[model samples]
Target: MPESAHVTEEKTLSESNPFPDSIPERLRAQWNFLIEVDKLKTVLRQSPLAAVERRENDAEHSWHLALMVPVLAEYADEPIDIGRTIQLVVVHDLIEIYAGDTPLYDAEAGRDQEARERAAADRLFPLLPDDQATHFRELWDEFEQRRTPEARFAKAMDRLQPFLLNWMARGGTWQAPGVTADDVRRRKSVIGDASGALWEAASELIAEGERRGWMRPGQG
Candidate 1:
Protein backbone atom coordinates (compact mmCIF):
# COMPACT_ATOMS: atom_id res chain seq x y z
CA MET A 1 0.00 0.00 0.00
CA PRO A 2 1.04 3.61 -0.43
CA GLU A 3 2.63 5.32 2.65
CA SER A 4 -0.30 7.73 2.98
CA ALA A 5 -2.83 4.85 2.91
CA HIS A 6 -0.80 2.88 5.50
CA VAL A 7 -0.63 5.92 7.82
CA THR A 8 -4.42 6.39 7.58
CA GLU A 9 -5.03 2.72 8.42
CA GLU A 10 -2.72 2.87 11.47
CA LYS A 11 -4.49 5.98 12.77
CA THR A 12 -7.88 4.28 12.39
CA LEU A 13 -6.71 1.22 14.29
CA SER A 14 -5.19 3.35 17.06
CA GLU A 15 -8.46 5.23 17.45
CA SER A 16 -10.49 2.06 17.62
CA ASN A 17 -8.18 0.21 20.04
CA PRO A 18 -6.98 2.76 22.53
CA PHE A 19 -5.83 0.44 25.34
CA PRO A 20 -3.96 -2.51 23.89
CA ASP A 21 -2.12 -3.79 27.01
CA SER A 22 -4.20 -5.71 29.51
CA ILE A 23 -2.74 -4.45 32.82
CA PRO A 24 -3.01 -0.70 32.38
CA GLU A 25 -6.21 -1.20 30.41
CA ARG A 26 -7.65 -3.27 33.21
CA LEU A 27 -6.76 -0.63 35.77
CA ARG A 28 -8.40 2.05 33.68
CA ALA A 29 -11.42 -0.16 33.13
CA GLN A 30 -11.69 -0.86 36.85
CA TRP A 31 -11.46 2.84 37.66
CA ASN A 32 -14.20 3.59 35.17
CA PHE A 33 -16.32 0.82 36.65
CA LEU A 34 -15.88 2.21 40.15
CA ILE A 35 -16.95 5.63 38.94
CA GLU A 36 -19.99 4.23 37.15
CA VAL A 37 -21.15 2.17 40.11
CA ASP A 38 -20.91 5.21 42.32
CA LYS A 39 -24.06 6.28 40.55
CA LEU A 40 -25.81 3.75 42.78
CA LYS A 41 -25.86 6.42 45.45
CA THR A 42 -28.25 8.40 43.30
CA VAL A 43 -30.80 5.63 42.82
CA LEU A 44 -33.15 5.78 45.77
CA ARG A 45 -35.35 2.92 47.03
CA GLN A 46 -38.83 3.19 48.44
CA SER A 47 -37.70 2.25 51.94
CA PRO A 48 -37.04 5.27 54.11
CA LEU A 49 -33.89 5.82 56.08
CA ALA A 50 -33.84 4.96 59.79
CA ALA A 51 -34.20 8.65 60.46
CA VAL A 52 -37.03 8.80 57.93
CA GLU A 53 -35.75 12.06 56.49
CA ARG A 54 -35.53 10.55 52.99
CA ARG A 55 -35.55 7.25 51.18
CA GLU A 56 -32.38 5.16 51.33
CA ASN A 57 -30.33 5.07 48.15
CA ASP A 58 -29.11 1.83 46.63
CA ALA A 59 -25.49 2.36 47.71
CA GLU A 60 -26.46 3.00 51.33
CA HIS A 61 -28.74 0.00 51.35
CA SER A 62 -26.02 -2.31 50.06
CA TRP A 63 -23.47 -1.00 52.54
CA HIS A 64 -25.90 -1.44 55.40
CA LEU A 65 -26.66 -5.00 54.39
CA ALA A 66 -22.96 -5.83 54.10
CA LEU A 67 -22.42 -4.45 57.59
CA MET A 68 -25.33 -6.48 58.87
CA VAL A 69 -23.82 -9.73 57.60
CA PRO A 70 -21.02 -9.75 60.14
CA VAL A 71 -23.18 -8.57 62.98
CA LEU A 72 -26.02 -10.99 62.33
CA ALA A 73 -24.30 -14.05 60.92
CA GLU A 74 -24.67 -15.91 64.18
CA TYR A 75 -28.40 -16.04 63.62
CA ALA A 76 -28.17 -17.90 60.34
CA ASP A 77 -29.81 -21.32 60.33
CA GLU A 78 -26.82 -22.85 58.60
CA PRO A 79 -23.14 -21.97 58.77
CA ILE A 80 -22.37 -19.14 56.36
CA ASP A 81 -19.23 -17.62 54.93
CA ILE A 82 -19.62 -14.11 56.24
CA GLY A 83 -17.20 -12.68 53.73
CA ARG A 84 -19.07 -14.26 50.82
CA THR A 85 -22.38 -13.14 52.28
CA ILE A 86 -21.05 -9.59 52.48
CA GLN A 87 -19.96 -9.74 48.87
CA LEU A 88 -23.37 -11.00 47.91
CA VAL A 89 -25.15 -8.18 49.72
CA VAL A 90 -22.82 -5.46 48.47
CA VAL A 91 -23.34 -6.24 44.80
CA HIS A 92 -26.94 -7.39 45.10
CA ASP A 93 -28.45 -4.05 44.20
CA LEU A 94 -25.88 -2.68 41.78
CA ILE A 95 -28.32 -3.50 38.99
CA GLU A 96 -30.72 -1.00 40.53
CA ILE A 97 -28.52 1.83 39.35
CA TYR A 98 -29.73 1.17 35.83
CA ALA A 99 -33.15 -0.39 36.49
CA GLY A 100 -34.23 1.88 39.35
CA ASP A 101 -35.79 0.58 42.59
CA THR A 102 -39.09 -1.28 42.43
CA PRO A 103 -41.32 -1.28 45.48
CA LEU A 104 -42.11 -4.79 46.69
CA TYR A 105 -45.83 -4.21 47.12
CA ASP A 106 -46.50 -2.65 43.76
CA ALA A 107 -47.62 -5.57 41.60
CA GLU A 108 -47.65 -3.26 38.62
CA ALA A 109 -44.12 -2.11 39.34
CA GLY A 110 -42.95 -5.76 39.45
CA ARG A 111 -44.14 -6.47 35.91
CA ASP A 112 -41.08 -7.41 33.80
CA GLN A 113 -38.91 -6.43 36.78
CA GLU A 114 -36.65 -9.44 36.36
CA ALA A 115 -36.01 -8.74 32.69
CA ARG A 116 -35.25 -5.08 33.40
CA GLU A 117 -32.86 -5.93 36.21
CA ARG A 118 -31.12 -8.63 34.19
CA ALA A 119 -30.61 -6.20 31.32
CA ALA A 120 -29.23 -3.65 33.75
CA ALA A 121 -26.84 -6.24 35.18
CA ASP A 122 -25.69 -7.22 31.70
CA ARG A 123 -24.86 -3.63 30.81
CA LEU A 124 -23.35 -2.57 34.13
CA PHE A 125 -21.22 -5.51 35.31
CA PRO A 126 -19.28 -5.79 32.03
CA LEU A 127 -18.00 -2.28 32.52
CA LEU A 128 -15.29 -3.67 34.79
CA PRO A 129 -12.24 -5.52 33.49
CA ASP A 130 -13.22 -8.97 32.24
CA ASP A 131 -12.11 -11.09 35.21
CA GLN A 132 -13.39 -8.71 37.80
CA ALA A 133 -16.58 -8.22 35.81
CA THR A 134 -17.22 -11.93 35.65
CA HIS A 135 -16.58 -12.40 39.37
CA PHE A 136 -18.82 -9.54 40.37
CA ARG A 137 -21.55 -10.71 38.04
CA GLU A 138 -21.37 -14.18 39.57
CA LEU A 139 -21.63 -12.72 43.05
CA TRP A 140 -24.68 -10.75 41.96
CA ASP A 141 -26.24 -13.80 40.37
CA GLU A 142 -25.61 -15.90 43.45
CA PHE A 143 -27.40 -13.35 45.56
CA GLU A 144 -30.34 -13.28 43.17
CA GLN A 145 -30.69 -17.03 42.92
CA ARG A 146 -30.86 -17.28 46.76
CA ARG A 147 -30.12 -21.01 46.82
CA THR A 148 -26.89 -21.12 48.81
CA PRO A 149 -26.47 -20.55 52.53
CA GLU A 150 -24.55 -17.32 52.04
CA ALA A 151 -27.16 -16.04 49.61
CA ARG A 152 -30.02 -17.02 51.91
CA PHE A 153 -28.46 -15.23 54.87
CA ALA A 154 -27.63 -12.25 52.69
CA LYS A 155 -31.22 -12.14 51.50
CA ALA A 156 -32.45 -12.38 55.05
CA MET A 157 -30.43 -9.33 55.97
CA ASP A 158 -31.81 -7.55 52.92
CA ARG A 159 -35.34 -8.19 54.08
CA LEU A 160 -34.66 -7.61 57.76
CA GLN A 161 -33.06 -4.21 57.24
CA PRO A 162 -36.12 -2.74 55.60
CA PHE A 163 -38.42 -4.54 57.98
CA LEU A 164 -36.63 -3.02 60.96
CA LEU A 165 -36.51 0.39 59.35
CA ASN A 166 -40.21 0.42 58.61
CA TRP A 167 -41.02 -0.77 62.09
CA MET A 168 -38.83 1.89 63.59
CA ALA A 169 -40.44 4.47 61.37
CA ARG A 170 -43.86 3.37 62.59
CA GLY A 171 -44.74 1.52 59.43
CA GLY A 172 -42.84 3.46 56.82
CA THR A 173 -44.20 1.73 53.72
CA TRP A 174 -46.74 -0.37 55.63
CA GLN A 175 -49.01 2.61 55.92
CA ALA A 176 -49.37 2.79 52.19
CA PRO A 177 -52.74 1.74 50.86
CA GLY A 178 -53.32 -1.98 50.22
CA VAL A 179 -50.39 -3.01 52.40
CA THR A 180 -51.60 -5.37 55.10
CA ALA A 181 -50.18 -7.67 57.74
CA ASP A 182 -50.50 -10.59 55.35
CA ASP A 183 -48.51 -8.73 52.75
CA VAL A 184 -45.77 -8.05 55.29
CA ARG A 185 -45.68 -11.71 56.32
CA ARG A 186 -45.61 -12.90 52.75
CA ARG A 187 -42.73 -10.62 51.83
CA LYS A 188 -40.82 -11.58 54.95
CA SER A 189 -41.34 -15.34 54.76
CA VAL A 190 -37.79 -15.97 53.63
CA ILE A 191 -36.40 -14.56 56.86
CA GLY A 192 -37.61 -17.60 58.76
CA ASP A 193 -35.75 -19.92 56.41
CA ALA A 194 -32.49 -18.05 56.97
CA SER A 195 -32.75 -17.38 60.71
CA GLY A 196 -35.45 -18.45 63.09
CA ALA A 197 -34.21 -15.91 65.64
CA LEU A 198 -34.45 -13.14 63.13
CA TRP A 199 -37.80 -14.46 62.03
CA GLU A 200 -39.11 -14.28 65.60
CA ALA A 201 -37.72 -10.78 66.06
CA ALA A 202 -39.36 -9.72 62.82
CA SER A 203 -42.59 -11.31 63.94
CA GLU A 204 -42.48 -9.30 67.13
CA LEU A 205 -42.02 -6.14 65.13
CA ILE A 206 -44.95 -7.04 62.91
CA ALA A 207 -47.10 -7.72 65.94
CA GLU A 208 -46.11 -4.40 67.45
CA GLY A 209 -46.92 -2.64 64.22
CA GLU A 210 -50.33 -4.22 64.30
CA ARG A 211 -50.97 -3.35 67.95
CA ARG A 212 -49.83 0.22 67.41
CA GLY A 213 -52.19 0.57 64.46
CA TRP A 214 -49.28 1.15 62.09
CA MET A 215 -50.07 -1.90 59.99
CA ARG A 216 -53.53 -2.80 58.77
CA PRO A 217 -55.28 -5.51 60.77
CA GLY A 218 -57.83 -8.33 60.20
CA GLN A 219 -56.68 -9.08 56.64
CA GLY A 220 -54.81 -12.23 57.59
Candidate 2:
Protein backbone atom coordinates (compact mmCIF):
# COMPACT_ATOMS: atom_id res chain seq x y z
CA MET A 1 0.00 0.00 0.00
CA PRO A 2 1.14 3.55 -0.66
CA GLU A 3 2.06 5.89 2.27
CA SER A 4 -0.96 8.09 1.46
CA ALA A 5 -3.24 5.05 1.81
CA HIS A 6 -1.62 4.09 5.11
CA VAL A 7 -2.01 7.64 6.43
CA THR A 8 -5.78 7.42 6.07
CA GLU A 9 -5.77 4.04 7.87
CA GLU A 10 -4.64 5.63 11.15
CA LYS A 11 -6.43 8.92 11.49
CA THR A 12 -5.95 11.18 14.50
CA LEU A 13 -9.21 12.04 16.24
CA SER A 14 -9.34 15.58 14.85
CA GLU A 15 -8.81 14.16 11.39
CA SER A 16 -11.50 11.52 11.90
CA ASN A 17 -14.15 14.25 12.02
CA PRO A 18 -13.36 17.13 9.75
CA PHE A 19 -15.82 19.62 11.23
CA PRO A 20 -17.72 21.86 8.85
CA ASP A 21 -16.71 25.51 8.80
CA SER A 22 -20.23 26.48 9.88
CA ILE A 23 -20.18 24.44 13.12
CA PRO A 24 -20.65 26.59 16.23
CA GLU A 25 -17.43 27.55 18.05
CA ARG A 26 -18.72 26.43 21.45
CA LEU A 27 -19.60 22.97 20.19
CA ARG A 28 -16.22 22.74 18.47
CA ALA A 29 -14.41 23.54 21.70
CA GLN A 30 -16.53 21.04 23.67
CA TRP A 31 -16.00 18.30 21.11
CA ASN A 32 -12.28 18.92 20.97
CA PHE A 33 -12.04 18.79 24.77
CA LEU A 34 -13.91 15.47 24.86
CA ILE A 35 -11.62 14.02 22.24
CA GLU A 36 -8.49 15.22 24.04
CA VAL A 37 -9.49 13.48 27.25
CA ASP A 38 -9.59 10.20 25.35
CA LYS A 39 -5.91 10.18 26.25
CA LEU A 40 -6.97 9.29 29.80
CA LYS A 41 -7.54 5.74 28.66
CA THR A 42 -3.79 5.48 28.00
CA VAL A 43 -2.54 6.65 31.41
CA LEU A 44 -1.99 3.38 33.28
CA ARG A 45 -1.84 2.97 37.06
CA GLN A 46 -0.17 0.50 39.42
CA SER A 47 -3.36 -1.30 40.42
CA PRO A 48 -4.20 -4.31 38.30
CA LEU A 49 -7.74 -4.70 37.10
CA ALA A 50 -9.49 -7.35 39.15
CA ALA A 51 -10.49 -9.32 36.07
CA VAL A 52 -7.54 -8.54 33.82
CA GLU A 53 -3.81 -9.22 33.85
CA ARG A 54 -2.86 -5.64 32.96
CA ARG A 55 -2.88 -2.47 35.02
CA GLU A 56 -5.96 -0.25 35.01
CA ASN A 57 -5.85 3.11 33.27
CA ASP A 58 -6.94 6.47 34.68
CA ALA A 59 -10.25 6.26 32.80
CA GLU A 60 -11.06 2.86 34.27
CA HIS A 61 -9.97 3.90 37.77
CA SER A 62 -12.15 7.02 37.67
CA TRP A 63 -15.12 5.08 36.34
CA HIS A 64 -14.72 2.47 39.07
CA LEU A 65 -14.57 5.13 41.76
CA ALA A 66 -17.68 6.83 40.39
CA LEU A 67 -19.58 3.56 40.33
CA MET A 68 -18.47 2.79 43.88
CA VAL A 69 -20.03 5.98 45.23
CA PRO A 70 -23.65 4.81 45.09
CA VAL A 71 -22.87 1.32 46.34
CA LEU A 72 -20.77 2.54 49.31
CA ALA A 73 -22.24 5.94 50.16
CA GLU A 74 -24.29 4.42 52.95
CA TYR A 75 -21.08 3.70 54.82
CA ALA A 76 -19.90 7.29 54.78
CA ASP A 77 -19.13 8.93 58.12
CA GLU A 78 -21.47 11.78 57.21
CA PRO A 79 -24.33 12.29 54.80
CA ILE A 80 -23.16 13.38 51.36
CA ASP A 81 -24.72 14.49 48.10
CA ILE A 82 -24.34 11.29 46.12
CA GLY A 83 -24.56 12.97 42.73
CA ARG A 84 -21.98 15.55 43.76
CA THR A 85 -19.70 12.87 45.15
CA ILE A 86 -19.88 11.04 41.85
CA GLN A 87 -18.97 14.19 40.01
CA LEU A 88 -16.00 14.74 42.29
CA VAL A 89 -14.64 11.27 41.70
CA VAL A 90 -15.13 11.55 37.94
CA VAL A 91 -13.21 14.80 37.74
CA HIS A 92 -10.68 14.08 40.49
CA ASP A 93 -8.21 12.31 38.27
CA LEU A 94 -8.89 13.83 34.87
CA ILE A 95 -5.84 15.92 35.65
CA GLU A 96 -3.94 12.68 35.42
CA ILE A 97 -4.78 12.73 31.73
CA TYR A 98 -1.97 15.25 31.57
CA ALA A 99 0.10 14.81 34.78
CA GLY A 100 0.19 11.04 34.40
CA ASP A 101 -0.34 8.47 37.15
CA THR A 102 1.78 8.58 40.29
CA PRO A 103 1.71 5.12 41.86
CA LEU A 104 0.64 4.99 45.50
CA TYR A 105 3.98 3.43 46.54
CA ASP A 106 6.23 5.85 44.63
CA ALA A 107 7.31 8.33 47.32
CA GLU A 108 9.94 10.00 45.17
CA ALA A 109 7.41 10.67 42.40
CA GLY A 110 4.83 11.68 44.98
CA ARG A 111 7.05 14.45 46.31
CA ASP A 112 6.31 16.52 43.17
CA GLN A 113 3.07 14.87 42.11
CA GLU A 114 0.88 17.65 43.46
CA ALA A 115 2.83 20.31 41.62
CA ARG A 116 2.59 18.36 38.38
CA GLU A 117 -1.13 17.68 38.72
CA ARG A 118 -1.86 21.29 39.58
CA ALA A 119 -0.12 22.41 36.43
CA ALA A 120 -2.05 19.78 34.51
CA ALA A 121 -5.35 20.99 35.97
CA ASP A 122 -4.57 24.51 34.85
CA ARG A 123 -4.08 23.38 31.28
CA LEU A 124 -6.72 20.69 30.94
CA PHE A 125 -9.77 22.08 32.78
CA PRO A 126 -9.93 25.14 30.61
CA LEU A 127 -10.51 22.98 27.61
CA LEU A 128 -14.18 22.84 28.48
CA PRO A 129 -16.78 25.56 28.05
CA ASP A 130 -16.24 28.36 30.55
CA ASP A 131 -19.01 27.34 32.95
CA GLN A 132 -18.24 23.65 32.81
CA ALA A 133 -14.54 24.42 33.05
CA THR A 134 -15.07 26.29 36.32
CA HIS A 135 -17.43 23.68 37.73
CA PHE A 136 -15.20 20.77 36.85
CA ARG A 137 -12.14 22.57 38.18
CA GLU A 138 -13.97 23.29 41.44
CA LEU A 139 -14.99 19.64 41.70
CA TRP A 140 -11.36 18.64 41.16
CA ASP A 141 -10.27 21.14 43.79
CA GLU A 142 -12.85 19.83 46.28
CA PHE A 143 -11.68 16.27 45.79
CA GLU A 144 -8.10 17.35 46.46
CA GLN A 145 -8.89 19.45 49.53
CA ARG A 146 -11.32 16.82 50.83
CA ARG A 147 -13.01 19.47 52.96
CA THR A 148 -16.66 18.71 52.18
CA PRO A 149 -18.60 15.55 52.99
CA GLU A 150 -19.03 14.80 49.31
CA ALA A 151 -15.33 15.33 48.69
CA ARG A 152 -14.43 13.18 51.71
CA PHE A 153 -16.58 10.28 50.60
CA ALA A 154 -15.37 10.67 47.03
CA LYS A 155 -11.82 10.45 48.30
CA ALA A 156 -12.64 7.43 50.47
CA MET A 157 -14.05 5.65 47.45
CA ASP A 158 -10.90 6.58 45.57
CA ARG A 159 -8.67 5.01 48.22
CA LEU A 160 -10.90 2.00 48.76
CA GLN A 161 -11.27 1.15 45.06
CA PRO A 162 -7.55 0.38 44.68
CA PHE A 163 -7.48 -1.36 48.03
CA LEU A 164 -10.23 -3.65 46.81
CA LEU A 165 -8.39 -4.18 43.52
CA ASN A 166 -5.19 -5.11 45.33
CA TRP A 167 -7.04 -7.66 47.43
CA MET A 168 -8.59 -9.09 44.30
CA ALA A 169 -5.12 -9.22 42.73
CA ARG A 170 -3.93 -11.20 45.77
CA GLY A 171 -1.71 -8.36 47.05
CA GLY A 172 -1.22 -6.33 43.83
CA THR A 173 0.89 -3.32 44.76
CA TRP A 174 1.13 -4.69 48.28
CA GLN A 175 3.85 -6.96 46.92
CA ALA A 176 5.97 -4.04 45.78
CA PRO A 177 9.45 -4.03 47.32
CA GLY A 178 9.62 -3.06 51.00
CA VAL A 179 5.84 -2.54 51.16
CA THR A 180 4.56 -3.85 54.47
CA ALA A 181 1.15 -4.47 55.96
CA ASP A 182 1.78 -1.50 58.25
CA ASP A 183 2.57 0.66 55.22
CA VAL A 184 -0.68 -0.35 53.63
CA ARG A 185 -2.46 0.34 56.91
CA ARG A 186 -0.99 3.82 57.21
CA ARG A 187 -1.70 4.79 53.60
CA LYS A 188 -5.22 3.38 53.52
CA SER A 189 -6.16 4.65 56.98
CA VAL A 190 -7.43 7.81 55.32
CA ILE A 191 -10.39 5.76 54.15
CA GLY A 192 -11.58 6.05 57.74
CA ASP A 193 -11.99 9.82 57.49
CA ALA A 194 -15.08 9.27 55.37
CA SER A 195 -16.22 5.78 56.32
CA GLY A 196 -15.22 3.98 59.44
CA ALA A 197 -17.18 0.95 58.31
CA LEU A 198 -15.25 0.64 55.06
CA TRP A 199 -12.03 1.23 56.98
CA GLU A 200 -12.86 -1.64 59.31
CA ALA A 201 -13.44 -3.90 56.32
CA ALA A 202 -10.20 -2.71 54.76
CA SER A 203 -8.37 -3.28 58.03
CA GLU A 204 -9.49 -6.89 58.05
CA LEU A 205 -8.22 -7.36 54.52
CA ILE A 206 -4.87 -5.82 55.41
CA ALA A 207 -4.56 -8.17 58.38
CA GLU A 208 -5.43 -11.09 56.16
CA GLY A 209 -2.79 -10.03 53.64
CA GLU A 210 -0.23 -9.96 56.42
CA ARG A 211 -1.29 -13.36 57.68
CA ARG A 212 -0.91 -14.74 54.18
CA GLY A 213 2.64 -13.34 53.98
CA TRP A 214 1.71 -11.01 51.17
CA MET A 215 3.20 -8.19 53.22
CA ARG A 216 5.33 -7.87 56.34
CA PRO A 217 4.01 -6.22 59.49
CA GLY A 218 6.69 -3.48 59.21
CA GLN A 219 6.95 -1.27 62.31
CA GLY A 220 3.62 -2.35 63.71
Clashes found in each candidate (C-alpha, N, C closer than 3 A): 0, 0
Worst 10 residues of 2 by lDDT: 1-10
Candidate 1 regions exceeding 4 Å error are 1-23
Model 1: lDDT of residue 46: 77
Pull out the clashing pairs in model 1.
Answer: none
Candidate 2: the clashing residue pairs are none
lDDT of 1 at 75: 91
lDDT, residue 107, model 2: 80
lDDT of 1 by residue, 84-173 (tens): 899999998887766777888888878978987898788878888788889999998998899899999998999999888887788999
Give the per-residue lDDT of model 2 (tens digit) for 17-56.
8667688978977887788678778777888998869988
Against the true structure, what is every candidate's RMSD? 9.8, 5.9
Using TM-score as the measure, the top candidate is 2
Scored by CA lDDT, what does every candidate get? Answer: 0.81, 0.83
Highest lDDT: which candidate? 2
RMSD of 2: 5.9
